[model samples]
Target: MLYYRQHFLHISNEGFIEIPRYIQTYLPHHLRVLIGQLQVSSHQLEIERGLSRGVPREERWCPICHTEVESEEHFVIGCPSYLDLRAEFQIEESLQLCMTMGDQWHLGRFLRATYERRERSLQLTHQTRVSTEQTITEFFQRVELHQRGPSIGLTLHQAAAQRARRRSRMVGYRRPQLYQEDISRINTTYNCMMEQRRTTTP
Candidate 1:
């Protein structure tokens, strides 16, 4: 109910135009914090002085965009610094679309992109794979080339989990007894069996 209300307000009050059909299908239960964060982030640009705590009083500049980091809004939505990094692709347009999307999914996209860009800049230019015995550099090299977003990473992890489940089942592994399967359709059958048990009890 809260999600519906927030989404309703986001679309009606905010300039958000449309919710993509793909995301609408799942219809997540709640989104209060996500909506609040986006609202705050958008408003942060309106502030004059920077909001960051760590910067010295004299050198209060945006670490990413070099502009004076005046407000939470500047750090998030106003600063032009990330545009160069994002310009490697059509990240600016994507970010704009995400901001106006008025949903948590769009916020997730922004967060994922921000994390990826920061990690890419701070970490090695190329992804590093480390292991005890082997560096697995070749495997990481392939994954790095794909350059897909975090969503793809999640898909890969899900695929791996499915594969593991299949392998375990093939090896005769059994889940615990308490791991129940859906039995709603068999309710009548179960009632009949109970009746037979009562009849045969004599």
Candidate 2:
């Protein structure tokens, strides 16, 4: 369990979960941190910061978008900064898409582009951070879905069918001890009748 957490749940200084090293190389360090935070929701987003600092609930609008309340979903799927990138990749901004889509190679490209566009120009916006989380979440979820191939119900049905077939074969089976006892009784009766016939004939 410790090993699993180290490899998969490892947290960075920015409070983002660490991704695999192979995929990590494809993304900039900051982008990787953003992805990690998105996956686990541990980042210092405006909403969280507000809660920590006792800032009013109404003041949580995205620092960048300034239109919608800063949230993970809005940042990833609705923020305007990523609209062009999302459109270019034909990526729909939906949780359903995140959880069910099988292909996510285009997402990598989108992330790289987004990262480059805002790398040094501005402070990372709540939308961007949330978007990064959503993208990573989608990628991981796709991988998980691929790994879990068939449904649990199908596997259970197969196992139950096997057990039923085995039980059906046993229905007509008899114990060897019962057959042995019957044979022994018939032999003893025949012996006694032979002795009686010999005694009477003599």
Candidate 3:
């Protein structure tokens, strides 16, 4: 709350806020996810995440900039790497307006492109099986599948297999709960016997 106010010009103070409209209007899932991440400053950018990972405040500077911390403001507007990207996206003004009130679809596309470049630049050190873009693609694939009636795209056998899986999950009793109270009682009895043995010993 205090943090956002410090960095941002517009911070919603209401009890419940609206999900940004561009998310629904935007067709690209990767872009949408990137936009949301950028808005919340929860993306791979150092910002505060580096602090949690034991990075010193001064050392958490942008890998690209090596001047200031990799905060949302720095990544979005201050970094030299994204100078061309900022012009491409028309993000020349306030960071708050560019992110919050600006054309989100355009901004989302910019973020997606920027993130890809960022990923590429950091690939030597930050390698992973699943990239942010891949996760977004897979997420939308599942969502589209569900929206199109779970088994719509599948063949007859695939549909049957899907149903079988659903049935198995729905009907399973799962692992029975191991009542922890029984273990507690056993430990108490053992401790009592051990105490008695010590007392009765010569």
Q: Largest lDDT belongs to which candidate?
A: 3
**How do the residues 127-188 of candidate 1 rate in per-residue lDDT, one tens digit apiece?**
33223213332333335656754532334446668888874355666775532344654676
Question: Using TM-score as the measure, which candidate wins?
Answer: 3
Superposed by TM-score, candidate 2 places the C-alpha of residue 197 at a distance from the truth, in angstroms, of: 99
What are the TM-scores, per candidate, against the unseen true structure? 0.28, 0.38, 0.52
User: Given candidate 2, what's the lDDT at residue 118?
Assistant: 48
Tell me the tens digit of each residue's lDDT in model 3 across 163-190. Answer: 8887444565586665799889989999
Stretches of candidate 3 off by over 4 Å are 1-21, 124-202
- lDDT of candidate 2 over 37-117, digit per residue (tens): 544555555666676788886888766668887655666577797788878877655733542351345555665576566
The runs of at least 3 residues in candidate 2 whose Cα sits more than 4 Å from the true structure, single-residue gaps closed, are 1-33, 99-102, 115-202
What lDDT does the true structure give each of the candidates? Answer: 0.46, 0.60, 0.71
lDDT for 48 (candidate 2) = 63
Tell me the spans in candidate 1 whose CA falls farther than 4 Å from its real position.
Answer: 1-59, 84-104, 122-202
- Enumerate residue pairs that collide in model 2: 38-133, 76-131
